[model samples]
Target: MSTTDDFDAEAWRAELEGYRDRKDEFFANERQSPIPADQRDAFDGLTYFDPDPAYRVEADVTPVESDETVVMETTVDTEQEYERVVELGFDVNGETATLVGYTGVGEDRDSLFVPFRDKTTGQQTYGAGRYMEFEVEGDVTEAETVTLDFNLAYHPFCAYNDAFACPLPPEENWLDVAVEAGERLPEV
Candidate 1:
């Protein structure tokens, strides 16, 4: 009998698999998803700010920005460090990708802001780039070796409708891999 606090990677994996199986239904029913009145008001008041100056990648790629960071909590066993807007660079299908994000802020102090897109846009994933949140180890000042996992990338609410104004991911955040995790767009 493992307690709730006991480590259970298999259970967590099973839960994620369930989400993947029902992603379509989850996204489709999101609009009708109910929330407490107070929570709804808070969600409504949330504003997403675009990155200023519009960071670019290649001549053909468009940049995206956002004010949200992926929230992750610190763990006792990891040597991870917290970082505020850590700078990271990678290559997506031979093209250069860059991302500047912060860590250690509000409630989820170990959170990370990773605004990114990939070559799969308009083909597999949402036409707009995806967002990912992760946990860091230490303070924001020491964020050089942060690990990024694409499996957590998710589409912004704006991707569902034009009525919402969402910031696009910067060109630098694009990933070359086909991230097969998280929510996918609802088929029209």
Candidate 2:
């Protein structure tokens, strides 16, 4: 996998197109979609911020070992516990910031769940937060360094309709900078 710092414009463009196409299919489909059934008719496809190669960052990953579990609140008013699997430190525009990556407590995890909020919240992006998850075998322990493609960050399921419950990003994962990438606010 390539980091965004050495972004290959041509490659990133192709990947972005694939992402948009998949989302378009998901939103347009009546079944197997997170979008509310009642609102499906009016859905013209989900909105997104222009893909920016700059949003992708290479992060240093550190494994977290703690007895405590993070219980995240969901839009449905319920809470679920997830293990804080890794800590990611990266530079965003000359400033150093850190974010936590979570994983479900089970036999094994195949992905890193990164949910975060930025200054763009309530304006350019979702007021609640945005999510980015990458397929990883086991945990970040396998690799001390990993790539965080923020350009693929996306609005939660609840953004489309309230029926689907989505986890809220913890305050610790919030960023002070405006991440003008990925999916934008959904039309209601």
Candidate 3:
């Protein structure tokens, strides 16, 4: 059998090769067509293989509301930007974070945005919020407010491409725990 040192060297080389292949394919797919929906879901389901696993701790839910609004800004000039709001909510740990979502014309129809960051940023996961798209459930939108689950967080396209300009996670959204779920930046 191959020695442990030899096995490690082979694994490192394989990882590097995989990263390069992924980088090439990422740009190619971006240029070619919209990423397939199934492919997107697959990426969204990725889990971190942490050398030092730091599982997410459940925190108490803290009710929150949105107070800021801005038009969606895009690096591509041709596409139209929509108005969005930066809302606030808490994790199971009571750590505060921002949610990014759409606002409707009528007061009752507005949706909530919940972007967040965690200790996994830049190390085990993307440095940006793992996005979780949510809509208000049931009749009571105030007291029955929803709390975000970091297991559903994700990285923006910018995580893969330098050409993409994704909004950075706000300071409040940054968490102190290692959120160990969702898509991770490919090894490349």
Candidate 4:
């Protein structure tokens, strides 16, 4: 965990709000939106917990040395393969926790994938889980730390429609703490 001494709470909040607005626009208007065609007429914006900087924390990134492969099960009957990349350790609301970060096998090397569930799962948020992904600067192996903005957490497309097969968060990445940030359960 790192101190937010240099964090600009106001700016961060503004940026997050903008992001949410753009996403809502896409979901409500885009033809490729995850919202079902029948529900598009009444489609509203996604629900989100208030943007709180407390949910945005700096995480220490510990790279995994082994070439470990994780077979993540999807919402459907299929599975996806990903390489275990790093362990992100951080503090959220005074609770210490760690989550595993992964990268799709043979996919973008710079993007880090972190699908996880919290106390909010199956209640205030998506029952399956939420996902957080960010681009790592330079090499992931050299990444010492990264920002984990839970305010950016979002539900997978499968949450809105069953046609999309989204990967379920592995048990290893489940957090005991209630991450009351980012998109909440859909109104539908």
* Residue range 1-188, candidate 1, lDDT tens digits: 11224545566556645654465344434554233333443333211222111121112112223445444322122232323355665443344555666544455555666666665676667787777766656654354344344444667665644445455554445666554444455444
- Weakest lDDT window of 10 consecutive positions for candidate 1: 51-60
Candidate 2 regions off by >4 Å? 1-7, 137-139, 186-188
The number of the candidate with the highest TM-score is 4
What is candidate 1's local distance difference test score? 0.48
Q: Which stretches of candidate 3 lie over 4 Å from their true place?
A: 1-110, 138-140
Model 4 spans with C-alpha error above 4 angstroms:
186-188
Q: lDDT for each of the candidates? A: 0.48, 0.82, 0.47, 0.90
* TM-score, per-candidate, Cα-based: 0.49, 0.90, 0.48, 0.95
Better of 1 and 4 by TM-score: 4
Residues 58-167, candidate 4: write the lDDT tens digits: 99989898877999999997999999888999999899999998999988779999999999999999999999999977888687778899999999999999999999
Backbone clash pairs for candidate 2 read none
**In candidate 3, what are the lDDT values of residues 1-188, reduced to their tens digit?**
11123335445446644654574466445444234533553443233343211223222333335444444433343232333443344344344444444443235534554455777677767765565555655532443244443434556666655566665554555667665655666675
RMSD from true fold, candidate 2: 2.4
lDDT of candidate 2 at residue 57, scale 0 to 100: 80
